[model samples]
Target: MLGGKSVLITGAGTGIGAAAARVFCREGAAVTLVARREKELAGLTAELTGAGHRAQYVLADVRQRADVARAVAAATEAFGGLDAAFNNAGLAAMPGPMHLVDDETYDSVMDTNVRGVWHCLQYEIAAMLEGGGGAIVNNSSTAGLVATVAGSPYIAAKHAVIGLTKAAANEYGSRGIRVNAIATGATRTGMLGEYLDQDPGREPAMAGKAMVGRLAAPHEIAEAAAWLCSDRSSYITGATVPVDGGRTAR
Candidate 1:
């Protein structure tokens, strides 16, 4: 559905971001993969290019506006213009009770989750405006919509993501830029695997929270994001579409 589109995917080194990179390329987008890890980004880029997909990698930390601007420029320069972006770069909150969460942990989560998206929106919007229009999908979490079993900083940062989604959507919808966020549920990402490995018994309890009785695959979340970034979701903007398996419905 994204035929010939120029798409940028942040956090493209692993998990849902990596999944989105593959899915977007399969759907015919020329993807620019952005992440902090050069090894992962290089390997993924090579894989896509080897498969005859137009792909490139930019090593960047989204918290820095200069890095974000350079990444945006790379996409537009490589593909001629920007068409869509999946701002999926983010950090998981460090596990701890609210009262015990240290300032360092809180700042890290907020800077990566909230400020990262802010940086992306500013640069991506400028690129889109110049190119006439585009679509953007920010990766918020189910934590964004309601409190969950997460650190306070994570919950707050996610809520900020949804708020930013609404604000950006409202400001740019008239300009042909559609901004939306995905309320992602528990997914079987590498990070989760590590947690589960430490306490295998915790899996069931985590799965039980979702009506589906299981965790989501990275691709499942990626599919939702891909659709949002495509013309298929043309009328969708300023909304938080839940990709959770009824976790919030309860």
Candidate 2:
């Protein structure tokens, strides 16, 4: 779907980000992977290139605007231009009740989950505009539509992601940029291993929430995201496509 397009993916060191990195490569896009961990990012980059895919890595903590700006510049310099971006960097805070959630928890979650995307958008949009516009997909969650099994911080941050996506879409779609979000179901990824470890018994209940009776795989969500970033979805914008395996069906 991507052909020779260049794409950037935040949090591309692991989980959904890594999965999407591979998927985009298979679809013929040169992918720029961004994350804080040098070892993980380098390892994934090597793996992709070893497989004959165009991939490279940049070290950046998306919570910081300067870091994100440098990462964007690195991607543009390496790929010539950015044709798309998956603003998917995020954090999963300790699960707890609203009243039980402390200020620190709220700040940390919002810094990475919300502000991270804000920083990414500012830079990626600039890069896209320079390249004559592109596409973006923020990693929203089912929590954005309602409550999460997590905390208020997660829900609030994801809701902000959706808001940002729609606002950007409305502002830039006319100028050839497409911005959208994915309300995703629980996925079997390293990010969710904690919950799975802490309460193995809750698995059935979590799966039951979706009509499909299972969590989505990271690659599944990647496909939905890649489609949105492709020319195939040219006419679509300002929309939240759900990849929740029917978690939001009810």
Top lDDT hit: 1
For each of the candidates, the C-alpha root-mean-square deviation to the true structure, in angstroms, is 0.8, 0.9
Report lDDT (Cα) of residue 117, candidate 1.
98
Q: Compute the lDDT of residue 116 as modeled in candidate 1.
A: 98
lDDT by residue (3-91, candidate 1, tens digit) is 99999999999999999999999999999999999999999999999999999999999999999999999999999999999999888
What stretches of model 1 exceed 4 Å from their correct place? none
Q: Which residue pairs of candidate 1 clash?
A: none
TM-score of each: 0.98, 0.98
Q: Write the residue-wise lDDT of candidate 2 on 43-68 in tens digits.
A: 99999999999999989999998999
Per-residue lDDT value at 159 in model 1: 98
- What is candidate 1's CA lDDT for residue 203? 84
